[model samples]
Target chain A: MTGSASGLESPAEDLLKVQDLLVHFPVKVPLIQRLISREKVVVHAVDGVSFSLKRGEILGLVGESGCGKTTVGRTIVRLLEPTSGRIIFEGRDISHLSQSKLRPLRRRMQIIFQDPHASLNPAMTIGRAIGHPLQIHGIVRDAEEVRQSVLDIMREVGLTPEDQLFDKYPGDLSGGQKQRAVIARAMILEPRLLVVDEGVAMLDMSVRAKVLELILNLKRRHGLTYLFITHDLATAKFLCDRIAIMYLGRVVELGPAASIYAEPKHPYTQALLQVIPTPDPDKRRKKILPRGEVPDAIHPPAGCRFHPRCQSVLPTCGWEGRDFIDLLDEHLSTSPKGVEDDELLGSIGEWWAEGFEAGRKTDAKDPKKLVERVKEILAKAPPAMAQAVQSVEAKGEFVIVQFRTPDKLVHTAVADRTVECLLYQ
Target chain B: MKAKHSDPKRASSLPEIPLPFLGRLIHPLIRERRSLAGALSWMGLGILFFFIFIAVFAPLLVPFSQTQPFASPVLQAPSLQHLMGTDNVGRDVLSRVIWGARTSLEIMAIGVLIALAVGFPVGLLSGYVGGKIDRLLVLIMDSIYAFPGLLLAALIAAVIGRGVFNIGIAITVIYIPLYFRVTRSQTLSVREEPYVEAARALGAKSHTVMFSYIAHSAIIAIPVIFSLSSADAILTAAGLSYLGLGLEVDTPGDWGRDLSDAQSFIGVGIWWMSVFPGLMIVILTVGLSFLGEGLNDIINPILRKERS
Candidate 1:
């Protein structure tokens, strides 16, 4: 991949590379429950996310709140351990390193949190909190030296009158000043890369612009690489050299910010870009929001994670038994003759779905009528859902509805970007 | 350019005032919460310090010996010679009351400090590095907390035998669970704060994050707990001494011991004997309770704001 910005030579050497990173958090279950169903449930927070950061490059991780962008940012910095995958920093795999072993490496990378108000120790003075890292890493032993360094960073971040503000507590600072102090704290370590996890998301609009300006300025001045995690595509367009649009826990589209904005390849990216509110009052546009809430991460949809909500969904996008069940439920709820359909279909509780196959008990009902009813429901469903059905037949005492196995989805190169969509594949 | 808005004069005009150790400790609390509750807390603090000062300067404050018995003047009422009157044994009632503050202060200091020292770390560890260890600690602390405070202290005092230190231990046992529960709960919440995560991302050691970030935030509740438990400790110490599980009689002046001694004299209407000591106990306990209540009012809002 080539760098997006003009007038800057793109470096071949990667400062940070994350390969197939996966972070799954185990959900706590009662002992008896765990033992009874020996299924180890986990939240697939960041699954198989891969990216690389070039020196001085600003890579934006953009997605909705639960899209695992924050988890990916945190996992890259080793704040959250990756359940699998390699995180190579400067040609060394540092993902699995113990915290003690990661200490020295931490000085080369840092994280700026989302909330300025909550990201500072209230009891600690601004100066002490900012300088604490130097003490922790034993980078500056002398208090005076640490103070000078902290004050320098404090000034750079525009928390001015640094000497006086040094003794003031975080409680004394406004939200903007607090965010600046937090930035100064991270900048004091002189890290090569920064994972800014929605760093300016909590700031006011005017202050957000200033902070974004400061971020860009810092990048230029310090030659720093940034893994900028934000949900605002407009902010990403403003600051990012490249943007990776994540959906659920996977990167759906990743390419130059300008190109992606000009021509979004993935349907998810297109939908995301289409929703950015225009500043002009006269230019009213239709918002193409993805249907339904983000699916639960515990059991992410198979084939394509976004297919369930994709507006331009293809037949092979990924249709499974759950989708069929969802279609049946929707048809029953909205059908004009719902009472007749309910009697024909029986209670949905007796239906069972696993993988691509759904079956209903036909012992009480006529098996031929059950198959006919299932076919009628499919005929009224979304074309993609109906087109994916392989067969509907009465086998033994059950009417089994089987769906075709979708082709394996893979990230494919489209114009100026790589998108994980069947449309591109 | 943005820095120009801030007045350099105003910034420099406020001189840094180097406070004395105790003033420094209390400066933030008083500064943050300046209300009627704050004034009441100050009054409570004053009462506590008044007792402490009397305890520290007991020898100079009262002239008559606390234990020495005179032949004539037994059961004398308040007069110029011996204010607060003389006890049944003719020992100065005023002197015994003044000296009793020392014993109570000692128990308060030992009980609170030991409880804080032990409970703070245990609770911090249990909450910060949670899992089986947390469950285990919560179980243990809850078990200890389930027993009635005075009953547990009395039982411990009964088993350990009697002395100032033994009574202090009894008070400590009663309060450790209190501190543990408060610190543990606070730590549990503070552990989830974004600041702690920021500190960890900065590569702070587990101990540093625990003590510096988690402990510092968790410690706000401790003072409230400290004041309340100290009031409880004073009562526990007195209860132990009254039940014959504290210092031996006449070795040092003790309110509980003196009150016990004056119990029989009440039938003769020599009220001076029990009244003064009982009054001291009541006054100190009320002061601490007010201090604790006022502090809770002042700090709870701050804690809630921090959480949000």
Candidate 2:
């Protein structure tokens, strides 16, 4: 099923809607250190993401590891509490609901994890593990009825000879069998929405195809909707109706799967698509993989999170003090140390940046020479970075560098999708 | 299409023994026979069972009452009439030694059971509901763990006074930290496992997740700690009695009290008074130690696999 019929569906048909959802995890600090600093630091795992899914939709959440696609999926199912935002499922706000209130709603939403071996309790038999949810929710009280329901779900998921496998432990089953059992456990509750977080990533290639097919089959039989989270684009293309491309905890582009694959709008999405391997030997497609490791989430880039690694970066695309410090650090480490250069700019350690302004103490050294050295460094830097700098001035014993305020970024609607980029705007 | 039933890795390693229960019990011992720990564990099990047999049949096996005096000369040597000969009180030494097994076993069982009863739930709550409760429990347990086992037992024994149950309670105080530390650490690790999270995601309450998922997996190391601590408790119990803080004089036979009484006679060359009882304590403690070590060797690999 694809998004051919999506345009015709009314807003009333929306099954789930997320508005600016944010999940920030506070970094643990020692008590003495915390008291002295009085500064609270948090990892902006899922900064501000908004998306919606229609009924009977299979929306794929595609991103690199640590980009927070899994976090979004978890937050939707209320497995993780959102720091701020609204999660409207079936027309009710579930974002701030208490756990007890969410318990009844749990029957309508479920999550299947990546590693099946770890997701099933080693001590519990497959039958008991699968039927436990029914008992917990008090849906099926009779022992025989629970067993019958468990056996039926097992048979549906293609775990044949269900009677024999029912009494077996997780260690007794193979990887594929364990995954199928995990899926069976989730499906036995007859949930309306399933968030499959890399559900088949750990399985063999042969088993992966079978599990994907089973997922599609289950959706068809139950008319279930899915928020599929995975790093594998090919698998997403094969299964998803819509695709949302995430980079550094934000969705850069979101649209129909076929159109996004055929013509990616965002630079990050284009870079991701080029890295996917093709079978043909004669076609040597140029790979444009992004450079540098992901920046720490504690202090993400000021403007667009992906601007640091974006190949098509613009002057207005959110570059700040941290980026300048990083560039200076790179320059200092590689170039041979000059006595004059060392005298003018004491060390990289003395330099500090916040927002668009970066300052370094002169310490009685000539401020004019420091300003000149900074300008000289900027001359050789990337054109976009150099153009973004507004001025460099010397005042008292400190040299200050100021960058221009970037153009306000927003999710602009392009041809058939929404892209958060200056190029689209 | 029917999926092929691959044999479970654990079941295949076990030999095809007739009795399922006995085979399961002996499987780890047989598998680990090549290791020194395994060999020692087997010897320990044998010694432990021998002592257990004596403790169970103390009434039938003893030749005289544990405390009664007879019309025989004191400090008599080994003979057919007195068997291992009479003590300084004109009582049979063999009967007292045989009866001491029952006392030691009683102290061990009660002491360890009490420690487990108090320590397990406290640890489970501390580890599972971690934060302030965890920090508080860890502080308390660490303070208890800092004290020497005998010294702590002695202090408690002195305050609680002497008797079988009181001595057991005294010994229990020394080991509370051991069980607490083991269970708490195990719970802390198991709480992070994916299965525990999965159970929580399935609408299971906090208590349900703690007991069913976390507790089930965390309990693997408890048995290993149990046997080893039982061995340690035997020593502490005897030490308490030796210091004259344990059972009353002329009560059912106790090794520590007997050892204490024999100390004054040892210089006069009455070797029988101390040798038999001392030998019994050493054998039982060593047996328990071997059992504990062997269990560690067998169970540790399984725990490691579970973690991975």
Candidate 3:
């Protein structure tokens, strides 16, 4: 762990370390539901995610929605309790600390939420909202000192006319002003680690850059360590010193921002980079687009979770009967000239990976010709899919396609990075 | 996160620009939900103050002792000597009615204060630290709430024995469930709000989060509930007294007991006995209801904003 922390001769030292954090939320069911369903269902929101933050470093956790990037940020600040993990902050394990025990440590770590509108109490005035931490933590004993400090911090956050805005409620402020107030409140305690969960995603385009700049300025001023969670790659590139690209509740790639942008290692990271629409239309950048939607976290792909959608997928990248069906469907959707009315096509939706036997009631005059046409179509498929197909035969008017059992791709070290693909493994 | 249609320049100026304290208090009354709040404030304040004044200065107005009877005619009608006439025992009916204000106020004050004291903290705990404790509290409160309030008060009063303190205790029992339910429900929602999470993130302990973040927001409904519950308490106390579960029969100036005594005199055309006590109960309850509704309009910003 110490060797990993000192990987590079960086000036700053490690401030926070998180190891193999898993947060699963049990789906609440009534007693009758529990009795009827023998198995307990849990949403694996964050599964085995781990990363560390260096002092004065901005580590962006970037992923698509439901990738559990936000959960990683929240769990670090102890906002959301991890099911099991080692969250060593300043060399102390505070992962499973009680609420009372966590209270004092809360002053050292803070979290700013995405929606400024929903982040401040509507009932409390701006002054009280910002000063509440000071009062609660006994940081400032005098009310006058708290007010003066609140006004000073308010000005620092660019909320001018602090005296006038002091008594105003959250509903009274605009989006940008509300965010500034929120930032002021979060920073007044001078927290060392800040978990910003999509903090600027709710602000308008005009104010986004200014807010981002303000964040950078604050980081420089206070030497703050940030776990910045966001889905926008562009913003993450601008603000994050280092970026961790997450996929299906795991960090697939973690490196410096410059290196990642220059040459992204993971397939998922490469696909995410391609998503940013280039302004220069003349330069047609070759995009490596993932094939389908993200797999469900509850039942993630057996090998690399990104394997189902990965364009750089190998034969051993968890390819199963469903993968074969997807390829068949894709081939048919594009050409479907011969098997346009196949009944089995619609029935593929109900089939799971565990071996299934279904017969198509076809009135085709030449079953041999149909099988030849399907074979011809299969020959044109991608090499990975083409190789996976073991058998394609016409058995009594039914065209059967059997795929080889896919070997699970295990994670292996490629250079300094961890890559979960057979090509690298 | 869509920018509202309102200009940014103006929206920034909307909340923080301070108005004078007096103006801030009066502004909502003038503009937001004007007609209803204004009418209620005037009527309710008028009646409420009238009762409060009577409660404070009952002795100054009453010519004779409230509990003891006078040497005047047993069933005297309205006259210059005995204003509003006299009861069947020759006691000045007006004196007892005036003094009834003090007794009614005592019940309202004791019942609400005790109910709030017991209900508020319990509700706050049940909501803020929800789990087995919350389930247990909800079960207990619901069980208590399931019984008809008046009947429960009567049952409690029967066990506690007939006295002013017993009456207040019985009324408190009925009102506690009301406060607990309201506070718990309000706390449940407030606890989930991001602001509460923000407070927790700011190093606030459990008690601080409960009282400062959750309770502070949840307490807005309290003034409304307090006024409304006072009205409820008045009726429940009167009902208990009328059912012989409240103050002793010999205790004079109790509106419920007075009403019970007035039943025999109604046949003899002694309308003053029933009319004054009944009107006092009606006026006080109406006053409290109006005050409660008026405070709600002022306190609930959503309702105030809708009207504006």
On lDDT, the leading prediction is 2
Looking at model 2, residue A213 earns an lDDT score of: 99
- Return the lDDT, model 3, position A197: 93
* Residue pairs with backbone atoms closer than 3 Å in model 1 (clashes): none
Candidate fnat values, all: 0.86, 0.61, 0.82
Scoring model 1 with DockQ, what do you get?
Answer: 0.54
Q: Write the per-residue lDDT of candidate 2 for residues B73-176, one digit (tens) a residue.
A: 78898899888878898888888888899999999999999999989888898999999989998999999899998998899888989889999999998888
Position A407, candidate 1: lDDT? 82
**Per-residue lDDT of model 2, residues A1-425, tens digit only:** 13523543454567789999999999999999998997798999998999999888999999999999999998999989999999988777899999998898888889999999999998788999999999999999999999999999999999878998888778879999999999999999998889999999999999999999999999999988999999999999999999999987899999999999999999999999987888896896878888798888898898888888888899899878877888888878776866666777768999999899898877755577778889998888888988898888987777888888888889999988999999888
TM-score of chain B of 3: 0.87
Docking class of 1: medium
Per-residue alpha-carbon lDDT of candidate 3 for residues B1-308, written as tens digits (9 for 90 to 100): 46657678866543332433333445556565457776786678788888999999988988776566655678788788877788888888888888888888888889999999999999999988899999999999999989999999999899989888888988899889889988998888778878888887887878888877777667767877898999999998888888878887666578888898899989988899899999999999999999888877676774345223
> Which residue pairs overlap in candidate 3's backbone?
none
Interface RMSD of 1: 2.8
Rank all candidate structures by their DockQ, best first, as comma-separated numbers. 1, 3, 2
* Model 1 chain A weakest lDDT span, ten residues long: A1-10
Model 1 quality (TM-score):
0.92
The residue-level lDDT of candidate 1 at A71 comes to 94
lDDT comparing candidate 3 with the true structure: 0.80
Model 2: lDDT of residue A284: 68
